[model samples]
Target: MAEEPMHSLARRFVDAWNSRDTAGLDALFHPDFRWHIAVTDHGDPEMRPLNSRLLHGMNLPWGKAIYNKKETIDIFSGIFAASEQFSLDLRTVIASGDRAALELVGDAVNPANGRRYDNLYCYVLHERDGQLVLLREYQDTLLLFDVWVAQ
Candidate 1:
C-alpha cells in the first residue's frame, strides 16, 4: 500500500486525541517528540520571553510544555482523567511536505467543576518518517486560565 499523505496524517493526529487513544498517540509521535506553547504576556512587566526548552517539565497553573513522547502521553492522560468529555473539532488543515498546520476547536467538560472548557487552537507540526517530531500550540491563554481556575 502507498503511504498516507501528510495531511491525512495530521487529521489522524486529531482523531487520536478525540478518541483519547493513548496507544494510537504513542505510535504517531516520534521518540523525541516535543510539544510547545507560546506564552502570552499575562500583564506582568517582569515576564520575559521563555525559551521552549527551558519550559519543558516545568508545571504551570494552566499546563506545562513537554518534551518526548512519554511526557506528551502523560499530559493527555491527565486531561482525559480530569474531563468527562474531551474532543477536538478540526476546522482546517494545511500541509506542505513534512509540515502541517491545524486549526482546531477543543471542547471539554471538567468533571470537578462542571464547567465547559472550550478554546480555539492552532497546532504547527513537523513530521519525520510518518511520526510527529514537534508540535507548537497556540491558544487563548486567558480562556485556559479561566477554565483551570474554575476547576
Candidate 2:
C-alpha cells in the first residue's frame, strides 16, 4: 500500500477537530485505531478519568490507550458534547512517509465544569493503509486533571 501524505492528513485532522466533526475524524482513521494520551509525571499516581475507563490497568511510556476506533470516537464525541466551545490552534507540523508529528494549543470551556481547558499538545501519528492507525499524544495531564477530573 502507498503511503499517504502527512500534510493532507494533518489538515483534515485540524479541520475535523476545529469543527468537532466526528464523522470527518472517523473517515481519517483505519478500522483499527488507537488514541493514547500521555500520563503526567509529577510523581503521583494517576486517577483515571471517570468518564473513560479505557485506560484501566494499562500504563506505557507512550501513554494511556483508548482501544479502538469506536471508543475513540465515543470519547471525542463526549468531549465535543460537553464543551461549550472547543478548538485547536496549530503551532507546527512535520511529516514523513507514514508518520506525522503535530504541535497544537487546545482551547476549550467545559461548561459542565465551568473551567477553561487550555493545553499544549504534541501528537505523533502513524498511518497504515493510508489511514491513521495509531496516535500518541503528549499534553499537560495535570491541567487536564484540574479542569476535567478534580472536583
Candidate 3:
C-alpha cells in the first residue's frame, strides 16, 4: 500500500455519502463495521453505542425527508465528517487509514424555539478492500431528535 492519503480516503467517503447513493455510500463502508451515537453531553462518558453505517443507511426515511443532500466533509486522516443533516453538510473533516475516525461539532439551532443545540460527534471507521465499509460514532441523539422532528 502507498499509505493512502487521508484526504483521498476522506473525500471518497464524503462524496459518496452526500450523494446519498445507497450503493455508492455502501461502497465506502466496511461490510462488518459498527457505529455509535451519544446524545446528551458531548463528552458524556456513558452512553449507548449504535452501528455507524448500518443505522444511517437503514434509515430510508431520511432520503425522503431531505430535499437535497447538500453537505461537505473536509477530508483529513483516520477520520471523516459523518455530521450531516439529511445528507446535507455530508462533507466532514475526517481521518483515514487502518482506523478512520470523524468528529462532528456543531450547533443545531431550532428556529421554532431559537435554541442553539450543542452537539459533538465522532465516527470511528473501518475499511474493507481499501475502502471505508464500516463506522462507529458518538453524538447527541437528544439534540438529533429535536433537530430531526423539527425537519
- Candidate 2 segments exceeding 4 Å error: 1-4, 40-64
Can you write out model 1's per-residue Cα lDDT over 1-151, one digit (the tens) per residue? 7644777878888889988999999999988887766563322213233346845443345334444579779888988888867899999888889998899999987676677778999998889887998887889876775677532
Instruction: Judging by TM-score, tell me the better candidate of 1 and 3.
Output: 1
lDDT string, candidate 3, 7-96, tens digits: 566666656654555555555545543332323234333534445764542321121211111111112110122333323233355554
TM-score of 1: 0.80
Tell me model 1's lDDT, rounded to 2 decimals: 0.76
The local lDDT score (0 to 100) that residue 86 gets in candidate 3 is: 29
Candidate 2 Cα deviation (angstroms), residue 148: 0.9
lDDT of each: 0.76, 0.77, 0.46
How many residue pairs clash (N, CA or C atoms closer than 3 angstroms) in each of the candidate models, in the order given?
A: 0, 0, 36
On lDDT, the stronger of 1 and 3 is 1
TM-scores, all candidates, are 0.80, 0.78, 0.47
Candidate 2: the clashing residue pairs are none
